[model samples]
Target: MPTPSYPPKPSPGDRIAVVSPSSGLPGLFPRPYELGLARLREEFGLEPVEYPATRRMGATPQERADDLHAAFADPEVKAVVASIGGDDQITVLPLLDRELLRSCPKPFFGWSDNTNLLAFLYDCGVVGYHGGSVMCELGRPGAMHPMTAESLRAALFTSGPYELRPAERWNDVDRDWADPATFESEPRSRPGGGWSWINADRVVEGRSWGGNLEILSWLLMADRAIARDESAYDGGVLILETSEELPGATEVFRILRCMGERGLLRRFPALLTARAKSWSFERPNNPQQAARYAADQRAAVERALRAYAPDTMAVFDVDFGHTDPQLVIPYGGTVRVDGPARRITVTY
Candidate 1:
């Protein structure tokens, strides 16, 4: 197994390339995209440079791949971030230049479908960030969540262990990006339930792995980017989260069952399950429905663990994915899960 190395951190004044590898949501919803870029500059002190397909709708996979190549190869671009996530980034994976990306390693920030690229970077021995997309995190409704901003700041600029705190308040309901009123104020968030632990009797520290649960299922089905040898991921922390699509509990368990069947579940000593996103524009789930969905999903996860890696320490309702006030998880970087101490820390 190849050890993943942390890429160079970008200073405040450095140039960061923003590309739309998945969807060109920026083109469709300019308000949030522009707002996110402005925050990148005004708040973070970093200049955002957009690529050719960044704001273009329906761009070809090759075009998106080219933008990624250009961003990583550019000496002036300190890091690369996705404008937003889309469903078809899997198509762009084959077109990427493996050698070029490996040679000019830089921090790439994204999640959801961006899991494809993050997995690829991991295979190439580079660490990638699992959260901090420009539109979602940076352009968040009215203002960035303080916890989110702080975590991203450390992940972007620092090179050490950063503690992960459960969100004081978190929300998964998304507003209409097209509506002007959506950005008028912060998204409505509810009191956090804090993290739930299972079999958390020991501490486990390992390089992080995993991403969007559905995206991971896609990667597994396609047999792309995943380590050919299961041992490659041995001892790595599995970081997983559901997206706004809000898959059913049965679907979640089936996917984990498949992984377990392939002898993949026992590799990880610890698992970090992000808070399930139970609401979507299409579903418009009521509060009761949302709670039921999350509960079912958690039950399915617990069943899988009991059947496969029963002793694997597990934590749920973590604010690391899809939820408001998301924390950045370093893909292929170090994650220390101290069950006894009730603390989670990641190497940025």
Candidate 2:
């Protein structure tokens, strides 16, 4: 596979394509979507161009692919950003025009279900930005977290090495987007206890890989995105994080087991796992329940490591994925995981 390269950065006044390759949550919840667009203009000084499917719910894979094609092929569209993430983005992957996308590479920014698109861009030799969604970040209630805003700004406009700092305060809890009152204040967060490290005796630096754990499991099952030979991922930093669906600890272990069995688990010399999102509207976990869930998830990860990548260094809760105050990671870009200094940096 060809090495992924960073696409050209968009200037402040350039246009950005706000395409919905996934679900059109923006149509259902226009409050946040509109706010996000406003911020893109006011704060970032970039014009957001919405595609036909951008606000259409129940858009088919073909429709989504068309939007993506138009977005990337348009010279005026400097970058492409997802309105929000959804479950079926994987279905749209097969419909994408690889040659077109390869010829007109753009920096794509999104996380969660949009991992599908990022994975596709990786194979196209383009570096994508993970963890900068419209509804979630730009439309954040009250205001964008200082750290998140800063990290995103750096990722979007700059091309250099950026050091990632652990969030001083972090959260996975969210309020109802439909409720008008939910926009009145920032989501609650707890004081961060620094990231937990296992086997922090060595430094690992290489191109980064991995995404939402559940999405990756699905990709592996569908024979999508992941390289044909696991060695394509060797030496790369592995990033894994769970979503708000809150899959059980047993499920998490099983997924890793499958990857390990496929010889994919030991490719990475280092792993950076996000803080688990234990609380969701479906299951509103209390403080104690949240703690137990986190513990179990971490333990499951450790168990998988012991069984398959015992020598891999891991750091948990480095402030990305499914969490508030997220930091943008450059997908397929260079990552430096320095265990001795407990510092993680990414090249944007």
Candidate 3:
């Protein structure tokens, strides 16, 4: 595969396309959608353009593909952002015009189900961002988390090596997006525990890959974004995070074991496991329960790494998943993991 290329950065006043390539929850929850768009204009100083299918629930894969094509093909739209992620983006991937996206590559920002598109773009040799959705992070109720906003600004406008910092305080519990009161204040948070590291003695640099674990598992089962040759991931940084669905430790192990069986785990020399999301609306875990959940999830990851790629350096709880104050990671772009120095830097 050819080395991936970085898309040109957009200026402050440039237009950005906001599309719903997965779910059109924007129609049901216009509050976050409107707030996100408003932030793009007021906070980020960029105009956000939406497509017809953006807010239309139950949009077909073909319709979603059309929105993606239109967003990337328009020269005026400097960047493409997902309104929010949904479960069915994997269905939309096969319908995309690879040639069109490759020819007119632009910075794409999204996470969760948008992992499908990010991985697809990686295969096409274009680096797409792995965080920064309009609704969840940008339209984040009260205001954009300070760290999230700062990191996003840097990723959008600048081109350089940006060091990532662990969040001082983080929240995994979500407030009701429908409740007007949810937008009045920031979500409750707890003091953040620092990152956990294993085999932390060397500095490794490579192209970044991986996203929501569940999404990647689906892609692997379908044999979609995964390269047939496992060697394609050699020297790549594998960054993964679980979703609010909260897959158990056993399930996590099974997925990594499958990746190991495919000869994928051994290819990457480094991994960044995102902070596991332990709380959800259905299972509102207390602080202690949440901690235990995170601990168990970390143990599962370590077990898999020890069995498959013992020498691969690992870092856990880097706060780039379902956690609040998420940072944007560059998919298929450069990531430098400095273990001894306890630092991580990604090329924007």
lDDT of 2 by residue, 1-348 (tens): 778899999989999999999999999999999989999999999999999999999999999999999999999999999999999999999999999999999999999998899888988888999898999999999999999999999999999999999888888888889999999998888998889899999999988889899999999899987776668789999999999999999999999999899988899999999988889999999999999999999999999999999999999988889988899999999999999998999998
Q: Candidate 3 lDDT, tens digit per residue, 171-231?
A: 8999888899889988878898888899999999999999999999999999897766667
> Which regions in candidate 3 have their CA more than 4 angstroms from the true location?
none
RMSD of 2: 0.7
Clash-forming residue pairs, model 1: none
Q: Which order, best to worst by lDDT?
A: 1, 3, 2
Compute the lDDT of residue 37 as modeled in candidate 2.
Answer: 95
Residue pair clashes in candidate 2: none
Candidate 1 TM-score over all chains jointly: 0.99
How much does candidate 3 score in TM-score?
Answer: 0.99
lDDT of each: 0.94, 0.92, 0.93
lDDT of 3: 0.93
Off by over 4 Å in 2: none
